[model samples]
Target chain A: MTEALLHVDAIETFYGPIQAIRGVSLEVAPHQIVTVLGANGAGKTTVLRTVSGILDPEAGKVVFEGKDIAHMAPDQVMRMGICHVPEGREVFPFLTVRENLMMGSYTRRDSDGIAKDLALCFRYFPRLEERQHQRAGLLSGGEQQMLAISRALMGKPKLLLLDEPSLGLSPILVQQIFEIIRRINQEQGVAILLVEQNAHIALKTADYGYVLEVGRIVAEDHCATLLGRDDIKEFYLGQKEAGVRGQRRWKKRRLWN
Target chain B: MEDAARLLQLVVNGAAAGCIYGLIALGFVLIYKATEMVNFAQGDIMMLGGFVAYSAIAHWGVNYWVGGLIAIAATAAFGYALDAIVLRRVIGQPQFAVVMLTLGLGFIFRAAAGITWGYDSVGFDTPFTNKTVKLGGLILGDDNLSIIAGTVLLCGVLYLFFAKTRLGVAMQASSQNQLAAYYMGIPVRNVFSMIWAISAGVAAVAGILLSPVSMIDVNMGFLGIKAFAAAVIGGFGSIPGSVIGGVFVGIVEQLAGYYLPAGFQEVTSNIVLLGMLFIRPQGLFAERMGKRV
Candidate 1:
């Protein structure tokens, strides 16, 4: 797997006394799209936060590009080529769209490279170019998400960590965003670790998938194989027929007896 | 003709004083914008700057220009230290705790200044002292003109700093969202300290300008309350609002002192502040507070 671009090995992270991620481990290979699928409150966001240095894991190491970055600050982590697109698209509302995109390249000194990336970003999301002078706060949800993704791309990151990019978006918009995500991975060769609750779309878009339940991974498989599983089809794909619930209830009752 | 001349003279005087208030309020707005802390010590920092410059000029017999530079550098260092050593520790704590800490620090600065320089008001010597420029029937003091020119120049430099410079833009981005700024590879903590240093340096300039007009003493810290009122009136977060608020407060105080009953000068700012709070709680240029989904 090309020595794995990001190796999050057996990391346990806590928020004060409550442990949010318990011995969770995952990896993303170079030029691959990896998705962590889970229900809400299943600690998917916690894993991404830990990997990106926003939260310190109590145990284990996060090796990125062959360096232990678990103890680094967020800015330091970013300098090492990891960019986190946080949950809820936390774009700088007061800054103009162009300024916000410029801020993404804050750590870099190569002006030519930055300018090139800026043009690339605008190309990826033409809406950003049309409203480059407008305040970011004025952008619609779909546009803001596009801006958020493009901003991360401006950093020229080796691995991008995206938390719930599809949340609260229309289905058509979600499809469009996923298409862009795939294009970014194929064209730019940037590794992506996507955390999402939209299991169906995530599995469809990703090459590999991990199923997180209650802070631990219960399933890991290639996206195509995982999509074909009966349990995944019934639970995550919402394929329950009209009589299926009753049949499953009777089957569970018999097992219990 | 005489009444019109008096009113013009009063307006000029008020504008000079308003410029000083605006300078001090700029410090408050800068610190608040960066750290979300109301630095009660802002006024005392000005007093400290005034005293420092006075000591350099009056006691050490340094050149006025040299003394002013020294005071600015010293005050900026002190401010940077305060944030790095003290305020940095209180980050993520309750807002009330940070406010009280600043209030206590203000008192400490006042007491320290009193101990070092004594409580007596001392004359502040400047090159502009006693120099007046005459234009027809009206006379303008060099000190007042200098204050006005200095305020305009300082504000212009600050505007360019925020609008044109890379570091300044990064600082503005950090002020807007620290976590997001950090995610963008901005050193947020260093930006906070830099904001403190700049605020202190500005406050020091205001103090040095003010001392020749009003004698340098520990009681000079009381001007902070007026500046605070200006910040509140301007909408706490806005920079230009601070200057406008300061000018508004200054004009109102001058008018109140001239036409109203005794002691009206003391309550004028508070009165305007209260009116502002009641009429438009969001300062004139309040940044739109949008909820992030």
Candidate 2:
């Protein structure tokens, strides 16, 4: 994979007393769009949190650009060019849209670069430009999601860890978000590690995929190959074999139909 | 005409005193907003500011203006250190634990002040001391006027800083969502320490402005109780609300003292505080949702 950009080696993360992600080793090549597909309670969010330094792994290492960053603080991880857009899009509700975007670039000292990146964000989401002065709390759910991604983009991150961008989004919006994600990876070369339950679009947009089941990687392959797997269809795609059609497996996940 | 002048005089006097409460309340609000920790020692910090100014101006023969500025800076440094070394350790603990810790810190500050600055009440010479200005038919003490003026200036700067500046907005962001601010590459822990410094500086300004009207002593920090009431009435979250609440408390106390019998003046703030709790616990300018104290 032309040398990995972020290599997560057999990490274990504990959320309080409960061990969330265990022995989960995965690698993302530079500028590659990687997707981790999992059902509810499979530790998808935990995996991203561990890599982003929100939850430090009890065991194993997260090597970013060949530097060991395990157990570092979230701010330090961010300063090293790993930005995490956490679950629930925790944007500053009181600040104006433009102010929220400015916050994303808080580490940067160059005014010109910040200004250019700001313009770039607005171009990506014209809706944000129209309401730059409006309070972010007042934005619709979809608009807030757009703002969330745009805010992360403002950091000019080398690696972006996005947790379920499609959660609570419309089908059209999901498609649009993935399309933009694809464009961002290609144009900006910001390698993305996205965790999603929406298997269809995730398989379509990502270059590589990992199937996580209960704190473990069950499958790892190219997106196209993962798409062609029968097990992937049954469990994630919500489709069964011809004779077993309409009779779903009890373990089948709730997919975006 | 005499009655009108007396009422205006009472209002100005009340407002001046209330500005002190507001300033102290401001310290609480700043720290609370940024860190969700209510510093009960905020009043003691104000006391320290005044005592530092006293030493700088009277003992060392520094200019009053320069001494006051130095006191503010020195107190700010103390506040920063207090957070970096002490309060920073208490993050993520229960609110009750923080409340108790800060309350304990207040007693320690008092004892420390007693040892450092002595038990006796001290006063400093300000440019406005003993001066009076006649505006039309009314006479106003420069001490009272200076307090009002200083508050206006400080509040203006704070308002502009939080509204217009990048670091100020970043401060707002840090308080609203710490994890998000960290993701933005802001050093949230450091930002918190900086907020502590600013809060301490604001408390120091209150101490300096209050020198002529009141004496600076180890017990001067008890005024923080009144300021706490002021913060509650201002919704505990809003900046301007706390100041206005202080002014309101001050003006009401003055009116009660003038109209009612003697000894009623002392209980007036407590009564107002209790009444506000009963009538509007959320405060006058409360946000839609309040974080539980």
Candidate 3:
């Protein structure tokens, strides 16, 4: 009922001639966590990239805080308080961890607010504080993920578009990162639009979920309802039935239509 | 004692020349760092700066300091315009195209300078003309001392700029990963233009320093080839490495010209460059870490 913090209308994106995302629409309310669940090459990353203005969409709109930012540059999008933690944790390799965090606040001019944010980032990820002077490339995968998330937080974003937070991490680290994500959402009241392959944790953490196939959103619902669906269980939750793969595939096609 | 004094003098002279080469090499590193494109016009830009300063001082009758400032400003604007007009269009193109574009631009700049200023070598009058300073046992020319002092001062300023300033850090961030920097609210295109401008400004300073020692001419742009070798030897990514590499090349060239065959001065830098390529293609201070995933 209330207005969404971010509204993504039916956006169509392309890579040269090949269309990557076709008419994908989504929304995230203030302080809510919405997850987009799909397998690799299902246009999950493309959706995030389109919203973040890295790749301009050929159609539809990206409205952030009631402003149409569909044609803005990536930096202009970030200036409007939308921070994107891209896939692969592209932290500056040669920069120290502290400097990496500093880069997150590049748009801000308030020194006091920046200092506060830096302290807050270090508090959330104490390992960052411990190796604040160390180059970011030297950090372990889990640590780098933490640094990446914390770096996004430093932007003081009203909405965070996370590409993949649990990518290439141990189970324990995934849980830890998800816990931090939940805490960040709740404590900071920051909205999140998360794209993930780990449907279990994503469904557990997010309030709403969307299922994407190829470049289209096939299904979407409240997380609790979606988690209980048969298709979601069979496809995303890894519920396997011997000799039923083809049958399930046909059934899924029927369901999508 | 005489031998020691002679060696010290050679070292000092080599260091002065090396600093000029390093200044030009710094331009190469700056542009290469920001865009991964080598600007072959760097040396020609230096020559252009020298001519600009010469015109300002000789024809316009401006003060020496004012002329130097004009030279730096003019060259910086030219560099910025070059990036904005030509290089910006071919940003994501192949490296070979960028290289050839810059090489062609270098030739254009050289020809422009020759047509504008004529081919005759001209002397630049500086305040330090014919001045010399006596050290403990050695005589040091004011020109060499100023070159060394100018290099040290410029390096210090650059170090502080990169370490302490926000715009400088943003430039560094953009150089490392432009997309990530853009996501972080840094205008990456502006940062690239600024890098080119600063590089050109630095090259101009090198030209101003070199002009007082050697005559200013279009052929002075050929010195950029040596600076290119210096950049390769120092590791293209490292700023400090460029200076050290420049100095090493300068010393080798000086010593070779003195001790080896008459034509060996020109070949010494290439020999060192080939040797560096064979032994350590990554250069002396190249980052050892594998690319991040």
**Superposition error at B192 for model 2 (Å):** 0.8
Interface RMSD of each: 1.3, 2.1, 1.0
- Model 1 lDDT tens row, A32-151: 999998888899999998988889999999999899999999999999999999999999888889989989999988999999999998888999999999989899998999999988
Give the per-residue lDDT of model 1 (tens digit) for B1-293.
88888888778888888888889999999999888888988999999999999989989999999999999999999999999999999988999999999999998998998899999998767988888998777888888888888888989999999877778888988987887888899999988998999999999999999876888889898899999999999988899999889988998899889989999988999999999999999887798765343
lDDT of 3 at A20: 88
Give me the iRMSD of candidate 1, please.
1.3
Per-candidate Cα lDDT values, in order, are: 0.90, 0.92, 0.91
Clash pairs (backbone) in predicted model 1? none
TM-score of each: 0.96, 0.97, 0.97
Strongest candidate by DockQ: 3
TM-score of chain A of each: 0.94, 0.95, 0.96
List candidate 1 segments past 4 Å from native. A241-244, A247-257, B291-293
Ten consecutive residues with minimal summed lDDT in candidate 1 chain A? A248-257
TM-score of 3: 0.97
lDDT of 2 by residue, B1-293 (tens): 99999999999999998999999999999999899899999999999999999999999999999999999999999999999999999999999999999999999999999999899998988899899999877899999999999999999999999999889999999999888898888888989999999999999999999999888999999989989999999989899999999998888888899989998878888899999999999998887743311
Better of 1 and 2 by lDDT: 2
> Taking the tens digit of each residue's C-alpha lDDT, what string does model 3 give over A1-257?
37999999999999999998989999999999999999999999999988888999999999998999999999999999999998989999888998999999998989999999888888778999999999998999889898889989999999999998989999999998999899999989999999999999999999999999889999999999988887888889987667656674776767766
